[model samples]
Every structure is written in C-alpha cells, then in structure tokens.
Target: MKVLYLGDLVGRSGREAAIKRLPELRERLKADFVVVNGENAAGGFGITPAICDDLFAAGTDVIVTGNHVWDNRDILPHFQRENRLLRPANFPEGAPGRGIGVYDVPGGRRIAVAQVMGRIFMDAMDCPFRAVDKALAAYPLGRTVQFTLVDVHAEATSEKMAMGHHLDGRATMVVGTHTHAPTADHQIFSGGTAYMSDIGMCGDYDSVIGMQKAEPIRRFIHKTPGARFAPADGEATVCGVFVESDDKTGLATRIDPVRVGPRLAETMPEVV
Candidate 1:
C-alpha cells in the first residue's frame, strides 16, 4: 500500500495549494490513501465545514487536526457528521469528533488513520500513547488492515519521535505535524515503519511558520501584543511524505519527501 500524508495547512494559500495539487499528486505518486492535516486551514486558526468539503472534493481521504481543531466554533457540530475529519484521539471523552477512522480502499484493502496530540508545551490532554494503543488494538496491521497511519500533531520533536517508536512495526507509517517546518529525518525504522519528525506545512515558507512575518516580528521585538497573526499569502510550498509499504506485512518499504512550489527546493519522488 502507498500512502501520502501532508502536514498542517496554514490558511488560504496552504489549502488552495493543496486543492490545486492533490489530484496530480495522487496520480503521480500512485497513493492508495491520502491524509492531510487541516488544523490551520481556516484563517490560520481552525478549520470549518466548507474548507473540509473543499479538501475532500480535492481528493483528501481523511483530514486530521491538532490543538486548533476547536478554534472554530462552527466545526463543533460538523465533527459528528463527518467521521473523515478527526481531532486528536487523546482528547477527553465526550469530545465532538472521534480520533480515529477506518476506511476501505479500492482494491478491497483497508486503511486506518489515527491522530494524537502531544502534551509537551501544548494543552493538557489524555495520554497520547495509551490513546493510540487503544485505537490500534482493534485494527491489527497486516491482518485486519492493509495499512495504518498515525499523525502525531505535536510541538516537540521528541514527543513525536517517541510516538513513532512506540508504534513501530505495528503501523505502516508514523509521521508528525504542527511544527510547520519539514525535518530531514525521513527514514524507515528497523521494524519497517516509516517515520518523519515533521512533514512541514503546505503554506508559504517566507514568513514565520506560515504566518505574516511583520506581526510576529513585532511581538518578538516589542514584547507586546500587536496585530493578529495572519497567514502569508505568497505562493505556498506543498509539503508531505510519501510511503510505500509491503502488502503482506503492512510495513514501509520506501519513504520519500514531497515538496513542491516556490520558496523551497522542489523534490518529488520518481513515479516509476
């Protein structure tokens, strides 16, 4: 099974780039499943039902979110209606949406996706490790599902790496998001699980973590609240990770970084 996981989408630029590029990306990468982090899709705060629909129509199989998942009050009810949109599984019980989803693939295969937010330097939440373990327990890789993916939407790389190691061998790929900066540590673990500290954001890299540079710069320099942080409207660089896994073992065989657009070195896996 081949899967492509894109990191957080910051704002209009990020989401628009994703919508424009996803179809061709799926075809060129031959991805069987696609998961995109849409936490910051709505004006760099939270996502909405309309943005979710646009992403879904553009070929996203599932959309995962992080701390900002609740930033938009309008999305609270939509969560119950759309299982494809996920908040962190570690969120307290009674949260609006689920943290995991299992979907059927075209060739009679199945793929399970789960998202967990880390506690380090972020909001307090349930134990992410336990949450993921409980989620994966029902769908054993290679037997019940042909592919499994876990998105560790976190602030600290250490936390994300720990989650990857924790789920090694059991999942096809374990990737991180929320950092908005791509890490160069894309590699398959000894247990055959693909891991990347962070896949990066699908937004402009010219600003401070996809936000307009001026306001963030002002806050840092003046140490006072200024204008709101807005998404950089420049051309965005679509960033993600691509993994191909073994059908029988449901483990990654190859992993590669996918970066497209301006303000970054362009890299795409060879289709063949």
Candidate 2:
C-alpha cells in the first residue's frame, strides 16, 4: 500500500496547488491513497464543503483538519454527511465530525486514517495519547485494516516525536501537521512506522507561513492588531510525505519528503 499525506493547506494558493498538481503528484508518487489536511484552506482559517469537493475530485481520498476545523460554522452541518472529512479525534464527544475513517483500497484491503490534536501548545483537548491508543486498538493493522496512519496536529515537536515513538509498531505512519514548516526528519522506525515531525504547508512560501506577509509583520512590530489575515496568493509549493508499505504486512518500508513549486526545490520518493 502507498499513502501520500499532505500537510496543512494554507488558502487559495495552497488549494490551487493541490487542485492543479495533485493528479500529477499521484501519478509521479504512484500513490494508492491520498490524505490532505484542509484546516487552513478557507482563507487560512476554515475549510468549506466546496473546497473539499474540489480536493476529492482531484483524487484526494480523505481530508484531515486541525485546531481551526470549526472556524467556519457552515462545516458543522456538512460533517454529519461527509465521511471523507475528518476533525481531530481528541475533540470532545458529540463534536460535529468524526476523526476515524476507513476506506476500501483494492483486493479487499482497507486503509484507515485518523487525526488527533496535541495540547502542549495548541488548544486543549482530550488526551491525544489515550485517544490514539483507543483508535489503534479498535483497528489492528494487517488484520483489522491493511494499513493505517494517524496525523498528530500540534505545535510542539517533542509531543509529536513522543507520539511517533508511542505508536511506533502500531501504525503505518505518524505524521505531524500545524507547524507549516516541514521538518527534516523522515525515517521508518524500527517498528515499521514511518515518521515525520511535520509535512509542511502547501502554499506560497514567500509569506509568513501561508498568510500574507505584511499583516503578521506589522502586528509583531507594533504589538497591535492589523488587517485581518489572508492567504498568500503567490505561487505555491505542494508539500507532503510519501510512504510505501509492505504488501503483506502493511508496514512502511520506505519514506520520503515531497515538495514541488517555485519556492522550494522539488522532491519525490521512489515508492509503492
């Protein structure tokens, strides 16, 4: 099994990056499944149903989100109907959407995807460690599911690293999002789980993170609110992680970083 996991989509530039390049990416990566984080797709705040549809039409299998998942109130109602979209699993019970989604791949194989939030420097939520433990227990790899990945969206790198180690032998991969900047660590653990501290954002790298550079800079220098934040509309770099899993055991055998655009040098892994 092969999975391509994209980091947070910043906004127009990010969304456009995926819509325009995703099909080619899938072909180049030879990915069998694709998961993208869309929390920041809507003007860098919240994602909408229409945006999700575009990503799906572009060959995305599942969409993951983070702390800003609920920024746009319209998504709450759609959550009940769209199983492909996911919020953090650690969110309180009765939350609008689910975090765990299992979809069929080929040859009767199944790929399970889940998202969880970290509390170290992010919004408070249920214990992500416990939440992920329960989730992995519910679906054992190579038995209950052919492959599985858990997205740990957090700010603290230590928390993400800990989670990666905690679920080392359990999940096929443990990818971190929310930091926007991609980390250099992409390694398959001794237990077969692929790990990356962050996948990086898909948007214009020229700006501050993904937002327009001016406002963030002004606010930082003046210590006062400036204009509302907006997504950087310049050329975007598609960023993500690619992994190839063992056919029978469904454990990751290789992992690599992917980045393609004018801002960052291109990267693609030999896989699947």
Predicted model with the maximum lDDT? 1
Residue lDDT tens for model 2, 8-65: 9999999998889999989988888999999999999999999999999999999999
Model 1 misplacement above 4 A: none
- TM-scores for all candidates: the values are 0.99, 0.98
Estimate the overall C-alpha local distance difference test score of candidate 2: 0.91
Please report, in order, the local distance difference test score of every candidate based on alpha carbons: 0.94, 0.91
- Name the regions of candidate 2 deviating beyond 4 angstroms: none
Clashes of 2: 0
Q: After superposition, how far is residue 57 of candidate 2 from its true place, in Å?
A: 0.5
User: How big is the positional error of residue 208 in model 1, measured in Å on the Cα after superposition?
Assistant: 0.4
